[model samples]
Target: MAANIVFTRIDNRLVHGQVGVTWTKAVNANLLLVANDEAASDPLMQKLMSTTAESSGAGIRFFTLQHTIDIISKAADRQHIFIVVKTPQDCEKLIAGGVPIKTVNVGNMHFAQGKTEITKKVYVDADDKKALLDIAHKGVDIYIQDYPGEKKTTVDDALLSKVQ
Candidate 1:
């Protein structure tokens, strides 16, 4: 049985109001999978995510990066899943592990000292760009779009705009 993955997104915030509500509803995803090592090991974070999901009427689960690949690889046929990772590197890991990702949404990445602002809501450094480019090379379309209905800006366009 193969999982029906609606979308794979990278959001530093993980399962917050926008993702727990907006993106999940946009993809009509029953399962909100978070693949992050830090969050997976944190009980408080898990509890908070669970609470948020419950309030939003969405199912949520947290998995370590490798476990996420293992579990998602064997997901049931009827599972309508939406994957969220904290970094593009995580998305690359899943994709490389054969997650069958088609489009990757760049939701939010806050500005850091070493990171360049790619968009109002997204920031990245060299490693981040490399990971995103790697995902792109695997034939996955990478776009920066905070929410579902908002205009999507392709990674190429974002980079181009940065140079212009």
Candidate 2:
């Protein structure tokens, strides 16, 4: 029994104010899952995420990518889920591992050493663009927007090529 995934977002900064409050309410999700390997293993980050969730009034969990793949189905049956992954590549891996990711929201991925800016908030390198293209090929809609009310920039082939 997989949990019903109401929303999926790719945000480097997981469990932030907007995600803790706005997106959780928008999706009507009770469970906020931070599915990132680094964050799940770090106690400091775990505490911070928990503290953020306390204010949002949403149940939150953290799991590494493999752990998420193992437990997501059963968890979904119990709670309406909202998942946030740290990168597009992670999201792609999750989808390949059997999570039914119908749509992916690219929120905030900070500028890295080898990455170029595609949008004001999104920066990607060749690998990132490739991962996003792969996800899109699997029939998942990948779009960018940090806030709920803002316009979503779809990551179509044209946009991906431009970035690459």
Query: Per-residue lDDT tens digits of candidate 2, residues 1-164?
Result: 55699999999898888999999998888889999999988999999888887787889999999999988877647688899998989999999999978999999989989898889999999989999999999999889988888999999788877775
Error of 2 at 79 (Å): 0.9
Clashing pairs in 2: 1-73, 2-73, 3-76, 3-77
TM-score of each: 0.93, 0.95
Q: lDDT per residue, candidate 1, 25-138, as tens digits?
A: 878888888889999999999998888777667788899999987877688767788888999999999888877789999989899888888889998888888888888777
Which residue pairs clash within candidate 1?
none
Give the Cα lDDT of each candidate.
Answer: 0.85, 0.89
Who wins the lDDT comparison?
Answer: 2
Specify the poorest-scoring 10-residue window by lDDT in model 1.
155-164
